[model samples]
Target: MPVFLTIETTCDETAAALVTDQLEVLASVVASQDKLHQQYGGVVPEIASRAHVERILPVIHETVQRAGISLADIDAVAVAYTPGLAGSLLVGVTAAKTLALALGKPLIGINHLQAHIYACRMAAGRDVFPCVGLVISGGHTCLYRCRDPLDFELLGTTIDDAAGEAFDKVAVMLGLPYPGGPSIQKAAEKGDPHKYAFPRALLDDPNTLDFSFSGLKTAVRYAITGPGRHDPSQVKLSDQEVADLAASFQEAVVDCLVGKSFRALEITGFHRLCVGGGVAANKRLRTRLEEEAARRNVDLVIAPLKLCTDNAVMGAIAVEKWKAGVFDDLYLDAEPGVVRRSSALIHG
Candidate 1:
């Protein structure tokens, strides 16, 4: 099987990976920017770009060495070219293009969202067709009707803040910590999700599969403070209060995902479900979704917690493009405001 050297610098992480056509990861390395972005409360594009420039080369070197191959053995250079910050995207694109040219190999540009779906398949070692892929991360919360590995149609998406973003914002409002998902999940382990009845937005939209987490996030904020969306200083949360809020917020997000995902399965007659993105790492979600899938006799494949977030091994998503002869040229440039535009909306 042909092997590709892949790179992903769409956001705060700088990653380089080597994957075979069989989806066997030879070596994958990620230089995370979590610490740098922690103080800022979120990913800052300028900082992300500079960090990528600094980390890309070293990460690539390490991955290739770990893979036990030199640039000469790689068949192509693959990179995420869409749906990412321009500065960060540029770093990956330029590096990929340069490698492709220097190595005299084909250049492949990939869609970041599509890669997330493909990741489920790679981790599961089976087709994720006829399923729904719920991508919940700081940057995105989209429901896709994945007809095939490469062919997907967007069924719904976030109209405002994403689920992961909601967690981050709520974390800040609660004075919890940065990178809200983990912190919230950790605290949620001790809280009661049913203790609070937070709202789930756009649950009844007649013609849209769109989601809105801004309201839920606001709800979390208001619960802790007297008034205002985010007045953490107004009220003090005992240890119990923090856990309860985290649990409640996590439950709200999970319920919304479960409702929407099951509907996608029922409507499309696709019993298999694929969950990806950072928030997919939530322990509650993994258990609940699996239970739901089992109850309905449907197959639900959730990636390992490690694969749930943005990492390089998942970059093997390019294997399909490589096999399909879908290659790019050296003229590729990066776009900071890359949005993973929906493929299409499918009813059935």
Candidate 2:
């Protein structure tokens, strides 16, 4: 079986993986930059790219070593090059291109969002195309109609801040830690989801699929500080107050995500739904999705907690392109922003 080397550095996580053509993950390694970014309350692009440069080689070396294989064993080199920070994407793309050229191997460029959806295919151990894919993360909150492993139609995307970005911002407002998804989830456990009644933007608009989390995030800020209040430093919140705010903010985000996702299903008529990304790992969101999927009788495939976050293993989606004989030249460059199709909102 042919083996592939996959690199992922779309964001703060630096990861590499070795996988067989049959989708068996022989070895996977990831180096996280959470501590580096934690103090900033969010990712600093320069810090992230620097970390990737420093960690990518070691990660790939460790993955190859763990797989008991030499660089010569790799038939192809795949790296996610689009829809991420420019510097971070360049680090991975440059490394992959160099390795591919050095090994005389084919270079495959992976779409970070599509790879997130492919994490479901990896988990299922079979084909999972022709489904609705929802990617919820710090950088993205969008829905796609997956026509195949590589073909995706953008159904809807965030008009402003993403769901996970809102989480991180809200966490900061509440004086919680960075990488807000987990921290907020922990604080929310003791609070009530219905306590504050945060706004669920665009939820009532049955005609449009685009999401707007900016308003919701602003609502959280206003709740913490009065309507005209700008600084949260003036307001001292108790443990219970903080927890309640966290729970309420999280609930609003989840409701918007779930509502829009199911709406995409209704519009696209896709029976199976695959969700992946950092926010997908939230316990409350997972439970809500599971319960709703059961009630709606929709097949829901969520990337396991281990796979939910950014990782090179998901880059195995390159296998599909490989079989199709699709490959990129060494001239491939990093695309920092999401290149969306001309089609905008999916109107019902």
Candidate 3:
């Protein structure tokens, strides 16, 4: 089996993995910078890049060791080089390029967002193509028509803040932790999702698949701050109030996500839906999607919790390209913007 080394530093996680041509992950190692970025309430690019610089080599070393493979055994080097923070991406790209040059191996460039959807395929251990793919994370909330491992056509995208970003911002208002998905999920456990009828933005239009979370986020801000210059430190609420708000917000976000996803399936005439990205790890989102998928008779495949968030295991998506004999030049660069293409659908 042809084995490849994959590196992923698209964000705060310095991760590396070893995988075979058969999509079997032999070893995966990640060094999270959660503690470093926790105090900032969000990721600081400079800090993330610095952390990646410090941890990338060690992470790769551990992955190789765990895989029980020597440097000479790696057939190629794969790295997520697109759709991420430029600095963070540079660290991984540079490392991969150096390894490819030093070890005389091929370099494969992976799209971070595409890799997220590919996680579903890795977990399913089968072909999940020609399905609707949903990627929801702090930086991305978009739907795609994934025809193959490398072929993705954009169906819709968020016009404002991503769902995970809304969670983090609302968490900040509620004095929760930096990575708000889990925090809000924990707080919402005891609260009522129906306490407040939070707006499900852009759900009224059947023709549009795009998402809008900015208005909902604004509603939450006004509810807590009441149209004034707000100080997160000064905002105070009872534990119950906090929980209720969290529940309500989370419900709204989930409604938008699941609703739009099923709508995409209906429009595309696809029965299979694959979901990935960090927010895919949310317990509530997972449960709600599972229920909806069952009711609507749509097959749902979500990335495993460990693979939901950014990691090098997904970077093994490069294996697909490797099989296709796709390789990147040393001059490949990182793309910080969301990757998208014109809609493939045609209308009268």
Candidate 4:
């Protein structure tokens, strides 16, 4: 029962967690920078990185305290160092490396994307590999063939904006709050999903698993504030109008996500499907997935709502690497772009 302390600062959240090799989350803490970035309606990298610098240590300390564990009880220090903001990723990687060195523990660099999928394993309390893993978030919309804990084969990725990004942009258009996912979900609850038939990108292509939300986003923009459309700010829109737009947009995104995910399962021939990331927390998306999975008789695991968003608890995926002796040296550096494997490390 080796316990690992994990840190995550991939984007706007500074998080830390304590978890056992068995995938039990002893404690988890996340410091959100949503208020800091809310005014901007999106994440500002420099602001996010600085916020992480200010909050990372405090988060880790709180997590350890909540877990009721001393530093000596930790077996390894893990951090998600890839596929994230360069400056933010650096904050977590540097913290983990220092802790591992100071405590004489093994250092494990976790892939943020893979850990998102691993959140399924953590929640399921069992193995969930050899499945189609769909990661839908603000920055990434991709599917992978997860053959094992550490082995993932790239299946399809977004050619344009991710599903979550579209939600944010559309939320801004509707004059909603910065985190469009929740705001839109709330609005859609009162609106009509069929008010507008938004485009479902790549839905017609059965062979392709990649997603395209940019077109959908653009369509929403034109529908609301295009040439002939009244300016959103100048025109007083009825509550029903706002709700309708939100509902329609959400329905379109959910349709695409559910449809493609099932298609991925079909192509992979895997009865189990795992979905992760912030967008996966959407209630509509969850309902549609559940309905479809039931109809198809496929075992599905949506990362628990809390784990659906970025958090260090998912970093417990590092335990798999710890057991396999897959350790990273102190020289490991943060990788901002998408990377398939750990060999994409740069010495610090």
User: Which candidate number has the best TM-score?
Assistant: 2
The global C-alpha lDDT for each of the candidates, from Candidate 1 onward, is 0.84, 0.93, 0.90, 0.89
Q: Encode model 3's per-residue lDDT on 36-129: one tens digit a residue.
A: 9889888899999999999999999999899988989999999999888999999999999999999999999999999999999999988998
How much is 313 displaced in model 1, in angstroms? 1.3
Candidate 3 runs further than 4 Å off: 343-348
Per-residue lDDT of 252-320 in model 1, one digit per residue for the tens? 998888878877777677888898899999989988998899899998888788878888777787888
What would the per-residue lDDT of candidate 2 be over residues 1-348, giving only the tens digit for each residue?
989999999999999999999999999998999999999999999999999989999999999999999999999999999999999999999999999999999999999999999999999887888999999999998899888997898888998998889999989999999999999999999999999978899998988778899998888889888898779857999999999999999999999999999999999888999999999999999999999999999999999999999999999999999999999998999999864844645742
- Cα lDDT tens digits, model 4, 1-348, are 899999999999999999988788899999999999899889999999999999988998999899998989999999999989999999999999999999999999999999999999998988898898999999998888887999887777888898888899889888899898999999999999999989998887865777899988877777777756755666556889899999999999999888888887877788999999999999999999999999999999999999999999999889999889899999999989863423211110
Best by lDDT: 2
Please give the clash total of every predicted structure, in order.
4, 0, 0, 0
List candidate 4 segments past 4 Å from native.
228-235, 339-348
Shift in Å, residue 348, candidate 3:
9.9
lDDT minimum window of 10 residues, candidate 1: 337-346
- Write down the lDDT that model 4 would get: 0.89
Candidate 1 lDDT score at position 285: 91
* Models sorted by lDDT, best on top: 2, 3, 4, 1
